[model samples]
Target: MDVATVKKKVIVVMGATGAGKSRLALSLASHFPAVEIINADSMQVYRGLDVLTNKITPAESQGVPNHLLGNIDPSVEFTCKDFRDLAIPIIDDVLSRNRLPIIVGGTNYYIQALVSPYLADDVVEDMAEDSRISRLTDVDLNDINSASAFKLLNEIDPIAANRIHPNDQRKIQHYLSLYSTSGILPSTLFLGDTSRKWGRADNFRYNCCFIWVDAALPLLDRYVNDRVDSMIAAGLLNEVFDIYKPKSDYTRGLKQAIGVREFDEFFRAYFAADSSWVNSLTNDQVSSDDANMFTKPKLSGILNSHDSNTLRALLIEAIDKFKANTRKLLRRQRRRLNRLKSDFGWKMQYIDATKAFQDESDNSWSVWVVEPCVKIVRSFLLEQPGFLSSTGAPYNVLHLTSKDLCTQYVCEACGNRVLRGAHEWEQHRRGRVHKKRASRLNKCQRTFSVDQQAAKSADGELNSTFCNSP
Candidate 1:
């Protein structure tokens, strides 16, 4: 595949957790017909953490093939610098094969490094002088707040201070220690007359096509909630339990993630219980009512026993907060994409799931009704042997309808046929046919559920076929 012939050059999909980076990445990889995904997430690189990290499944990769995921052990301490080193070679290999590289993940810094060649070369060497760096252990780093770290960085290098956001504690600490020991700032080092040749632009080069898949705040929130639920269903708790050492740095990061952190708390609660006490309690085989009294409260109260409800509530709360944060981060990303479009004069397309499908239908003469989840669509695409072209485009994207729903014919109350095409579907939603039916259904004295009405309406009969007719 010639680079010039490609629609998107080197695509980068970025968003917060559960914003659908993996799904978008896989979708683009399948659609672009020339794209290979390069995992930019820090956690996704670790092995044995598919559920916790939301790592793309083998089935979801769709034979499109991904790099840098599940390559490192969770116990290993992999840094951003290590990512850059590994990524460059993989990118080069992809480009050499005439394939496009689509970088995807929530790790903002990783994507930043890849896109900004100047920053990629300004590597932070290991902190020397055991006195200063040793004092700033991983534990210390985790404990320090961003504000304090920013203050320290300002004292060392004001120029770097202005460049880095105060809220970004990780980068602030990294630069602070890097400059304090080396007596040279990253900005100074990167911009020095002799240092220009060492940067990514000077050494390696590739044109990029950046597309961001974004959703409205409401939709994004719902998506995030669904994503957390999916992660839990996929056994995220088990993954966290397998690596829940109190002293480990791995636990710290895991604890920071939304659903995983809740599991950590639950694990702590369980471990704190005396084994002998638990054994005695189990032997007693208390009545259900007695067990309830001893167990912890489900929602928000102290518990005398080991109840799982508290853990469930914690997980739900964590997921809600995570979704809110993810929406905020996605908005920031949208702003960045707009800024990049204005500055670089590159073609940047902002397409959510619905828009992407519409665009595909318009451009390729093929229509698809993709599930809300990207993983499902990706899995469907990749499972077909030879489904993807040599350049990595999906051969055929299938649009599936629910057999149960499709078996029915037209609208019930108004005798209107349910629109089949995307445009027709939209038109039907706006027209009086659906509106009148909705109004009548709301006023109906029958206690039939909305789903029952829909099923009846789908079958083209207003007579209680929805309730009586299966």
Candidate 2:
């Protein structure tokens, strides 16, 4: 197929965390007339997870339509295969309307699937044959352990095993299944001469462009730290706690996400009160002089005190690690880009949107401001298009304060909201309500222990060590 026959081409914006994927995507959508954004990130698909996932705000979208984002229930699973099925129709619809389709996200696998020729219709059809694959319609592959999937793949296709990375479980499984069913190796199929067929009515080709945003590691680390602080100020902890109710897996993906996971650790330490208990026990056994030996406060108070300096330090450390991981991730992305360029001769560009924005702004300054949640509530009023006064003027907008958005409350054992007051709030903290909930949650976490968690934790520790060491 010729370039013109491709009809509507797609531009994929991809990179790692703090690379400004969402900002760049929004900028591209705004600048490029008739370009629609299709969210290629797996975590951003969940609703009520705006801050943690760095989801594009409604204002950023500017009424420019977006697809496959904030639509899925967090409890349900979402996989690459599931994304492929959902995205195909959206892409077709965009092309049919003669609009440019831009797949933008930090999710490498998702963007790779869309931009690479690997997701041709026949491959998708072949994948649909397995019933195990059918069960993963709602699961997010980002939540799965790469090693587990790779192990399963190795059992099916040892030849494919030599070619696939143990950390790339998604591709390994796909190829293993393909080889097992068709008796044809995926590598051979990929290099074959048969043109991909997308049915008679939907026979279309695509020319793709890829753009990578580059940044210095230190700057990226600072950005992640600042972003995490912003999320906390935006009430991300309360939001996660609200969704992390009994037996609810909504926080599953969020728990795996960087900022969210750190916050989860903080929350776990805060509610358990185990640290406090341990401290009390130790203090009771120690002599008055000996008590001074243990200078550091218990983890419970350290975690829940909301001390600005301590929290900031923790956030910075987490971001530093995140930045190191991002560097490795970018290296992988560069390799993929090189492969794409070599095979398809696609044009690639590297633009630093953060630098561009800084240069464009007259202020030339960055500030962190914590506006009252009430202010957001107030903006909601003025945003309404039709509200007017009797004098034919727009109604004055109401801005909400932090107190209005969050009220203090008391509760008994079993975790229920009670009346609002300083007395009540103190009473709730002193009561057994939160303790019971924490105990139950601890039990639940142990009960639903997936092997994936262990693998992820091990990989995380290794990555952290590698990044921290000289």
Clashing pairs in 1: 10-209, 33-393, 62-382, 294-305, 295-305, 296-303, 412-457
The TM-score leader among the candidates is 1
The top-ranked prediction according to lDDT is 1
Candidate 2 backbone collisions, by pair: 77-138, 77-139, 78-138, 78-139, 78-140, 374-400, 374-401, 378-398
Judge candidate 2 against the unseen true structure and give its global Cα lDDT, from 0 to 1. 0.53
Off by over 4 Å in 1: 1-9, 13-21, 24-35, 75-77, 120-147, 186-204, 247-258, 262-264, 274-316, 342-346, 354-470
Candidate 2 lDDT over residue span 155-243, tens digit each: 65455564544555445556654554444545444333222211111222444445666555556656666766676567555556544
- Any idea what lDDT model 1 has? 0.55
Q: Count of backbone clashes for each model?
A: 7, 8
